[model samples]
Each structure stands twice: as C-alpha cells, then as structure tokens.
Target: MQIYKNLLLKNQTQSFIDDKKHEKIVVSNIQSRKNPEDKEDFSKLALANYLDEDTGFNPLGITAYKMNYFLPFAYSFGSLGNDNRKMEMKFQLSIKKRLFENLFGLNEKYYIGYTQTSWWQNYKHSSPFRETNYQPEFFVDFPLENHSFFNNLRLGILHESNGKGDENLESRSWNRIYASTAIFYERFLFVPRIWYRIPEKRKDDDNPDIRHYLGNFDLNLGYLGKDYFANIMLRNNLNLRRNKGAIQVDIGYDIFNNGIYWYLQYFNGYGESLIDYNRKLQRLSTGFLISY
Candidate 1:
C-alpha cells in the first residue's frame, strides 16, 4: 500500500512538470509569430517600444507612416500659374499610431495614420502655400506566414482632401476603402493597392472627375540597400481610350549612417496635388529625409 501511494505521487509531480513545459512552448510560438525575423519588422517593433518608453504612452506609440522629408528647392519644368513660381519648396509629414494588436488572435494589428504634403511658394511674394493635401486612414494589418513572396496584407478606409471647404469651388476631397499587400523578394519590396471611392451626391461632390487623374490603383516598388535606397510610385486610371497616369521616383543615401538621408525626388504626371489634380506636372526636388 505504501509503495503504491508513493508511485501515484511521483506520477502526479511528473505530469505537472510536463504541463508547464508545454505551456512555455506555446507561449514562445505566439511571441515568435508576433515578432517576425525581418529587418523592417524588427525596426518597427523597436521604434514603437522606444516611443512608448519615452512618452509613457503605454501600448499606444506613434511612428512614421510614410516618408518624411523637406525639399527647399523643387523646380518645375514649365509654368505652373500666374501667381505660382517655377521654383518652390515642398514638404511632407506622416505619422501613425497603433490602436490594438492581435485583437482576434490572428496576428493582426490596427492602426490610424495621417499624412500631409505641402507645396510652398516661398520665392513668391508673401510666401504663400500653393497647395496642401491631407490624408487620414484607419487600417488593419495581417502578417503572413510561410509565403513565398507575400509578407503582409492590409485593409483600410481613407479620406483625403485639400480642406478648402465643401462649399468652396477650390474644394477637393474623396473617401475610399482599399486593400493592399506587401511583397518581399531579396532586397526589394513591392506594395500594391486597389481602392474603390465612396459615391457622393452630385451637389456635395468635390472634384467629381478626380479619379480620371488619380486612378483606382497604385504600385510602390522599393529597393532597400545597406547604404542607399530607391523607391518608385506608379498610378494610372486604366482607361484604354483616354489613359492617364503618373510616376514618381525617390532616391536616398544614408547620411552619417544615422536615420537622416540625403534625398532626391522626381515627379512626372497628373494628380500630384489635390488643387492641380487635372494639370500635368514635372518637377525635380532634392532635400533631406528622416527615417526610422
């Protein structure tokens, strides 16, 4: 009887140890899924955590959503307008905040993002801002696993406007819901997105024909290098009869290997700005960029 009791106690102890081991394994797997083994992914996680530590914002940390840059000299190929000068300054500010992580146990995260781009005619009298575009969006990001080239998928709703008021003739605004994906191959990354504009009443609609220039789809291809990087953005209306499109290229070199980069950008096409969505533009700009 004594021997039997001792054996039963030992078996119970062994069973508890085995259960703990299994629990640890499960936790490790989940953590691995949350943090991927890519350079960009790791940097993003690090930036978020660092921001949280500095601002004491808990889990909500703000990070860069798009490229942040300031160009002092952007020269246009031809005349812009009577009031506008051929050479002007341009800048962009973009940011994002994470709202939730893994809400549905699917390794998905939610974020809110805002981006603003401005074209400033500093050389002109009074140095007025020619045009400014504002974009705000809410998105959910899903990390993919074991895919040959696909790395991430995102679904989002976006609103963009020039903020000139709905009643004003200079008003330009639109709302869209979009789907996009991130594909990675070697040192290159490709992001393609398709969007459907939300319909509005004819009376309330601003820039009704904006889609003919801005298009329903766009592609961003980038090359990530150790000391340099380059990106290309392409957009088209996809109309066979009256096709219209735009292309932008950006090249940057790491300055001092810090987060600052010397940047050069060239844009050729329509829809570069909301106020001039229908006008074609060709510009070359050089400036500095801040990256994480």
Candidate 2:
C-alpha cells in the first residue's frame, strides 16, 4: 500500500509538470502567431546575408539603407500637368553593404548604398511611369563615444539622376557631397545634413537653379514609440528674399503589433522627384513599410 501511494504521488507530480510545459508551449505559439517577428528584430535585421555563420567572415551583408515602402495610392492635391494623372503608385528600394570596418583604426565604417524611387502613373490611360530616380552613394560613418549631443557622423558623395535622355530636354541629374550627423534623445532622433552640389558642365546641366528649390541643408526629426513612429523632414534654401524648400511628414502605425506598419506620407513643396525638382506640389500617400 505504501509503495502504491508513493508511485501515485510521483505520477501526479510528473503530470503537473507536463501540463505546465504544455501550457507554456501553447502560450508561446499564440504569441508568435500574434507577432511573428517578435523573436527577431525585423526592422534592424539585414535584408540579405550571403555568407553563413560557418564562413566566419561576411563581406557582403546587405541591409536596408532607408525607408523601404510601397505606396499604391499616392494622390496629388494640385495640378499635375495635362498628360499626368492625379493618382498614382510610388515605391522606393534602398540597400547598403558595408565595405570595410575600422580599417584605419578610427572606428570609421565605409559603405556603399543604392536607392531607387519610382513614380508610376498606373491609373493613367497607358500606365506610363512618370519618373524614376536612381541614387548611388558611398559614405563613411563614424560612431562617437560619450557625446552628450551628437552620436554619429557621416560623410558621403551621392549622385542622383532620372534615367532620361538629354535629347528630349527631360534630363535631370545632380551630384553632391554631404555631411550629416545623428542626435538622439530618448525616443526622439534628429539628423541634420548639409550638402554642396558638384558642378556640371554648361551643356550637361539640366537644372541649374536646382539648389534654390532643393536647398543646401535639410533636417530630419523623428519620434519612435512602442507601436508607432513619425518623422518630419524640413528643407530651406535660406534665401532672404526668395526662400524656397520642402516639407515632408511620415507617420506609421503598427496596427497589429507586428513589425509591418501602415504608413502615411504628406509632402508639400519641391524636389519630390528628379523630374519635379523645380515643380512645387502637395501630395498625400498611404502605404506599407516593411522596414524603417
């Protein structure tokens, strides 16, 4: 009788442990279903890793360089010319790869980045692409330590162009050398950048006065929250009499508590695209952002 009682007690304890384990597994699965990317920080994860861990050294790890989003319904508020439509689709793809890290023992990292943005007139009659801007850049990032205000600095040279021939008078392109810094305070981020446009030949210049519209400096301010984020970009040419620039606002919400966000963007002013560098307009767009 004593042996039977002991055996029964042990069995009950084992059963209780099993039940707890099963409950934990079920809860984990439910949480995973709710937020699939919770275990991995999807927003910061590199989009591609060509080398495996066993390789020990990865020289070609590619990551998202800027906001990668697809805006299916971007509607302009004002006039957009006779042939262009008011509503269209827009998308951007940006990526970067680290070339060297701390090569000079200064903790400076070098990288190459490429970004492409396209404005598609999908709602138009023949669904022609309005404009596509391609930007390729090389930069060095220096991380600061014990800095009270600024945390990082970057210096880069960038070239952006609309893939258009000069024959039709539709060519637009620019080259710039820029310096930017990053400041962080709690959940807020501030980035200020200044750039100098490289000179082009008289015959090659498509937009000579582009600097007046796009400005020499720009400010980016962002607020990050647990389930939402917002960013405001401001640019000013700083002309005393004929001040001109642009403003863009972007807000994103994680409605399902997932990594993917529903994004809204508002832009007013010039330089929305290479072709529209000198044209001022207002646009409101809704989209989805996989990485920010």
Please provide TM-scores, in order, for all candidate models, with all chains considered together.
0.79, 0.82
For residue 221, give model 2's deviation from the true position in Å. 0.7
| Candidate 1 deviant stretches above 4 angstroms | 1-60, 166-168
Worst 10 residues of 2 by lDDT: 46-55
The TM-score measured for candidate 1 stands at 0.79
Clashing pairs in 2: none
**How many clashing pairs does model 1 include?**
0
lDDT of 1 by residue, 181-217 (tens): 8776777778899999999999888878989898999
- Poorest lDDT segment (10 consecutive residues) of candidate 1: 45-54
Q: In order, how many clashes per candidate?
A: 0, 0
Off-target runs (Cα >4 Å) in candidate 2 are 1-60
Tens-place lDDT digits, model 2, residues 102-212: 888988888899999999999988999999999999999887777977777899999999989978788999999999987767767788999999999988799999999
Error of 1 at 13 (Å): 47
